[model samples]
Every structure is written in structure tokens, then in C-alpha cells.
Target: MPQSAVDSPDLRLTLRVRAMRREARDVLSLELDDPAGGLLPPWEPGAHIDLRFANGVERQYSLCSDPADRTAWRVAILAESPSRGGSRYVHQTLRVGDLVTVSAPINHFALTPAAEYVFVAGGIGITPILPMLAEATRRGIPWRLAYLGSLAERMAFLDLPQLAGGDTLLVRGDLDTRLDLTAWIGSPTEQTGVYACGPERMLDALEQLSLDWPRGALHVERFQAKTFGESQGADTFEVVASRSDLVVSVDRGCSILEMLENAGIGVPSSCLEGVCGTCETAVIDGAPEHRDSILTPDERESNETMMICVSRSLGDRLVLDI
Candidate 1:
């Protein structure tokens, strides 16, 4: 048997916590090791890693380091105690010189190789965008970054402008007072692809603003899940797993994948927020009510697959080939 090229390992780099500092009130910057032998992965600007600790607590954090460095990747973590234990562990327990296993870089938010780029970052969401700013600077891509934060020091990558050589825009003030999304995003040229990553409010605002722009021109990555409550919107949907047929009764708040997982069905998932395409499943028969951000319109129309984590059946009854 031969291995498929896609299944082969990409650039897998062992990153050690070289330094940790308070980037903001709640955010912490973690500098990783470059490895003595120059062992590192080639990554694009918006790539991130699945960091695995000894306790098997793994979380995905966007790489904040410059891609050109090639020696190391930096990630910033905002401690969320109520959620996954990764951030808490990283912030409280993980220290300098501590080693953590990181998967090969994966990119969901990417620069579309346009003539010019506009980057918007809010709060700790600036991690991934920082690298893109660096890339735009290095390539002379005519880029501008609107870094909006409550305070100037809260924004860790202050050196971006110097690195970018005046090709950057740093807007520091209370988001309520300082943020001007329309003026920043609306004024951009049609060819510009707007890239944004930030808190839900900011992303939602950007999403609304994006509605006015041309499709495929606005790219965003959300770090949190939509709180739709436990009530699934649809009644009684059946999902047909390729391995087995399971007709699960879906309440208004119950998602198809949640039903399956509750029934002891194992489906691959991470970030259950629909940002990561880990829980994607094939749709055998049914119109999918897609809630995920990953799928394109063509892919959704094809009706071949659905990200079971957040997506649901469009029709009353969906038969998914799980």
C-alpha cells in the first residue's frame, strides 16, 4: 500500500516555550524555540498549530511569528477557564523551556494573493494577522493593517510598523471611540481582500459590513462558537452513517453531530465552532443547512459533505452518510 501525498506529514516543528509575557490584560505571548538544527516548517501567514501537552490537552493557537523566520513560531493565548483546559494550562502551568507537541501548520484564513490587502485585528485576534502584515511588508504588497485595541500597549506587535516601514496603520483607543469599520473597510478598492480576526462582536460587525462588499472579498476567522442554546431548530432528522444507519431524533436545539456523539458515534471534530473543518461529513441525502464558515457555495450546492459540528439539515429530514 502506498501513502497518499495529502496524508503525508507536512512541516511538523517541535516548539518549546522560549518566553512568556503578558501581551495585554488577558493575553500572553509565547515564543517558541527555533530548534538548534534550524528544523522548522514553511508556513503561510495565517497558519496555526494544534499544541499538545503531556496531559493530552490540545488547543489550536494562531502562529503570530513572522513566516520568514522559519526558525520558530510564536503564539499568544488568552486564558479561558470555563472552556478547554489548554489556555489555562499554557498560561498558568506552562513555563519557559517547557516542550509541547505541535502539529504541522494548518491554514484556514489565508491571503488570496491579491494586488493589495487590508487587515483588521481586534483584541488578541491580532496573532494571525501580524504574520500577514510582515508578509505584506516583505513582498511590498501594498498592504495596510488597522490594529484596533483599547490601549496601545495591549497590542503586542507594535514593531509591525517599523517592520512594515510605514505600510501599516495602528489605531489604538477604546473600540467604541476609535473603531471605524466602514471608513476602513468600505474605502478599500474592490480588488482588495479584507482579512479580519477578532472577537465575535467585531467579526459580526465585519460580517455585516462584508455583505455590502463583493463576495469572496472578505475573509474572517472566529475564535468562539455561536451560542444557539441547547434547542436544535429542526424536528426529527435522520442521519445515515456509511458504517451504520442511525436515525436520531433531533430536537430544535440538537445538532446532527451532537445527536450522533450522544449516541456514542465518533466523528472527528476540533474547535466545534465550524472554523476548523475537522468534523466534515458526507451528505448522502438531504439539503444541508450549513452554518460553518469553511464551505464555499459550490461545495454546499454539491451537497456531498457537511460539517456536522455546526451545520444541519436544510430540509425536515436529512440522511447523512456519516
Candidate 2:
């Protein structure tokens, strides 16, 4: 299948919750399977699926299970106290045997070929790294892990057999030991690939510290939307759908997505906040003032695509491959 098909919003599968188990405090691991006992779509490490709830709420969760397991897909979710209803619904309302609509696994954070790997995960961020550990082990690649949590009891999947080794460091908040990124992440080398998933503060620190590192040496996945510094002062712009041969004017106060919908053009969108990768349209012409958290600095420089939900044209007109 095409990459676009894999990322398409119209692609949805109804799967049954085969089992649910509590992994840690306020965290639950759910196993989803095809009700017909058939094989599910294959996924690589760092891929996530969008879970559509009955109440029309949608949330993305990273696949934590081994990618080799085609029979089932597993995701661990943390129940946030002030959740926008996604986590709470999974924790309180969702139950085993209930069918849920899930999208195909889409990976913006994919594992690249490297001689060695270094992984740093904080709290629930470890979910995506779990599968990466398995893949590295299978390929016999040298790897190390630093897993951090508030407490020992709150750290999920610590008891997993794969985590047993001297290379794996388990740090807790209540203890005196702390995660020092400066000390843990030394000067990045060409042979080493650094992957980190954590809170905004931790990611921010890592991003700043790795500035001098070799390009593409440091990779990160954020659980929250990035705080785009300062507004760009919104201005009216025009968008031309290359394929549709349609033109739409986006007002200063309105978004391109809103204007597209008004023109009867349907685009897949989930989190309109630019945190989710949905509504990412291919750019045929013109520069875009990228506002999405999912794209990297290099990707923004390429100008090959833009998330229409929050991003706008840098010039007066933008040509999109709709």
C-alpha cells in the first residue's frame, strides 16, 4: 500500500478488545485483535494508532508490543486526571470485548539504520521504545536505555525480561538519583543514534543540548504539542487544490481547513491543534509557515508538505496536491 493510504484518515478498522491489564498506577495495557481471528496490518517500531471512541473522541497511542506479533496489537494508556475525555473513556468506560474503531499504524518517528542506539524515556514515554528494544535485540545491535518515572511502583513494564541488564538504568523521582541528560547523552557520534520520548521540559532540554550534535543523530517524539514561539500575525491567503482544480480564500481569522470545508472539500482531521499528523497535505508550490509539532526542522526546510490545520501559506498563494 502507498504511504498516503497508510496515513489516510478514511482508513479505519474495527477491532475487538481481547484483553486489558493494569500495567502501573493509572496505566492500563489493552490488547486489540481482529474479531475474525485474521492477521492485522503490520507495523514497525514507533508507530501509533488512532483509537476512535464511541463518543466521537479520538486519541493516539503508541504500539508497545512486538511488531512480529501479527495476531494482536497492544497499547498502554495513562489516565490523565484532566484528560479531554480520551484517556478517561479508555480507563473508565472502555471494557474488554467492546469494539473500537482504530486507524492503521502511522509512524512519524521511525527507527533509522545506525551502528548503535541510545534510548531515553520518561514516564509513559517508554511505550514506543519497548518495541524498539525488541527490534534492536533481534538485529543484535548494541543499545542502552534510561527509563525514568516518578516512583518505582509507577514505572510500567519494569519487570519485563528484556529490561534486565547493566545497560538499562531505572531512575525514580522519590529517590536521590536523577536523570541528567547532559551526563547521559554525551557528544553524539556518527555511529550513535539517540532516541528520546518524554515530557516537554525534558524534550526541550534534549533539543537544546543536541544542537551541536551531528545532523540526524538526535531524534525525539513529543507527547504534547510544541509551544510555537510568538504568533506570526495571521494574514489572508489563497490555496489552490492542484488535483481538484479549486481555489479557496482563507481569511485572517480562519484556518485553511475551515476554508476548505466551506468549499466542500473534505480533509481528514483529528486534533486540530497540530499535535496529530492528520490533515498533512502535500505542497506542490509556495512556502508554508509551518506550525505543526510533528515535523522536524529539516522537514520544514524541505517544504514538501504542511499540516493544513494550523499551518498557512507564507506567500499569498499556496498550491497543494489535494
Candidate 3:
């Protein structure tokens, strides 16, 4: 499948897997390097790639390795309980030397500059946080972490030098009574950033706990789509895909992405429910009724981009940068 970039829409690379190793019990980390020993695109902490497997399954994985290392990119995959073709394929079928397709890194959960940071991670959610720790250390920023998992052996990269290098890391299993969010997170300050990525239950708890915190103090990324409400009452809208100069009417039941695809405009998309940021498109004109699970409230207010798969035009018509 073709992928779209914010700057270059038609950016996709076929990278060869250099190494695949078991990081935890069921967690496997894959190291992808350029096929011809060339440097890959530069990425910052918390950036992720839309990895398209040969089995025709595409999934998003966070770039967990040090961002300074541009020669190779590393991502850890968890073998979920119920097989979602992507993780299962990576665990069972994918080989070390096999070539795989990936999109340019896209980051919605970027490590913002802050006076300090509080990182909370659960299970496989630690992938993105692993890199942010290094970045924070390099920048000489004070930070603390509370890494939670069901079992010690289930957490990937617990032995990373960064984790060992810090005394503020509180890596604990679910049974550990000392994993107190109240004491660990404390009260948020104006310049302190609280970043978390995990299962819905943990994120939901963090969301409820951080309600009184600053508007943009806490950042979280979900592995699946949140509980989205019913369709909007004003569902019918016209979309002007400006790059292709195509206009189409999207009806009550249909989505902008569906309409665009039917019009022969193949925009890269996955998890059409709006969790993955794959179909995020630039908004040229008009306000979008943002519904994606990725963007923050600040981002939605900015109205710069929208996940066309699920979001609609707030007004009668919208001009999109296709």
C-alpha cells in the first residue's frame, strides 16, 4: 500500500531487516537497516512508522532505538492475545533478512521541550518512552518514569542502559503496591510534561487523574481507537481534494476517506476507525470536525490536519491538500 507523508506524500521505503531478537517472553524487537548500507531518514523521539508487512498487513510501531542512530531503526512488537495479523506475522512468519515496507516517520506524540517530564508506560507502551528517556538525558532535563507491566519478563528492554542509568525509574509489575500514581505523578507544574502510552484502562485512569492538570501537560497515545460517539447530525458534506482538484459529495453513512478512495484517490490508510495516524491529511481550508484518536485538544484546535478516514468537514464544504 502507498503511504503519504506530511511533506512528501509518496514516501515509502523497502528496508531490510538486519536483526530480530526476543526482547521479552513474547515481545520481539526488529532492527531494520538500509539495504545498501545507507542512512535512513532522520527521526526524533516518539516518531513511528507505518510498517507494511509482506502479508499485506500494515501496523504502526514506535521507533524505540536512539534517534541519534540514523543508520538503523528499531521497533518492538508484542504478540497480542488475539492475533491481529500484523503482530502475529512479525512473531511467526517474518524473517531477519526479509525486506519490509515502511512509511516515513510520523510523530503525533513528540517529546516537547519542558522543564521536566514524567513518563508513565504500561506493557508494550514502553516502546516510545524508551527513546524519550535518552533524549531527556542528553538534553540534561530532569525526568522520572513509572514503567508498569504484568510481569517483569514481559517488559521489553528493561536492561537498556538508560533504564539502568537512572535512579528515578520505578519499573514494577502490576502486583507491586508501590506503583502509586498519586505519589509518582504528584502535581503537574506549568513546564512539566507527563507522557504515557499504554492499554486503555491505564490511559483512562491517567486521563481521569490528570483532569485538573494543565491543558497540555499530559500526553498519551493509544494502541487502539477510543470510544467514539455516534455520527454527527450534519453528516453530508462536500470535500474538495485540491491536489487532484476533485470534488465529491460524502453522504451521511459514508466517510471522506471512503469517498476519496472510490474517486480513485488512493490515500494511505489503516485502522479506518481513526486510531492510527496513517490517513492524516493536511487541511487546506475550512474547519474539520476532528474525530481521530491521535490528535490532542491543542492540535484539534489548531485545525492543521485531520484523519480523513473518520473526520468530516465541520461546514458544508472542506478544501483538503489531498
Best by lDDT: 3
* lDDT leaderboard ranking: 3, 2, 1
Give each model a TM-score.
0.80, 0.94, 0.91
- Judge candidate 2 against the unseen true structure and give its global Cα lDDT, from 0 to 1: 0.85
User: What is the descending TM-score order?
Assistant: 2, 3, 1
Off by over 4 Å in 3: 1-10
Instruction: Count clashes in each candidate, considering only residues at least 3 apart in sequence or on different chains.
Output: 6, 0, 0
Model 3: per-residue lDDT, tens digit, 17-117? Answer: 99999999999999999999999999999988888888888788899999889899999999988987999999999998999988888888999999998
Candidate 2 Cα misplacement greater than 4 A, ranges: 1-10
Q: How much lDDT does each candidate structure score?
A: 0.72, 0.85, 0.86
Better of 1 and 3 by TM-score: 3
* Candidate 3 Cα deviation (angstroms), residue 125: 0.5
Candidate closer to the true structure by TM-score (higher is better), 1 or 2: 2
Best by TM-score: 2
RMSD, one per candidate, in order: 4.8, 2.9, 2.4
lDDT of 1 by residue, 1-322 (tens): 1111122345335668778888776678888876464658778988877777767676778998878776667899887758478887877788898887777777878777878888888878888888787777677778777777877666676654533543566677844467577986665557887888888888778877777776677788778764444334355566666567666767666666778878777675666677766667887787877788766545778888887877876567777676
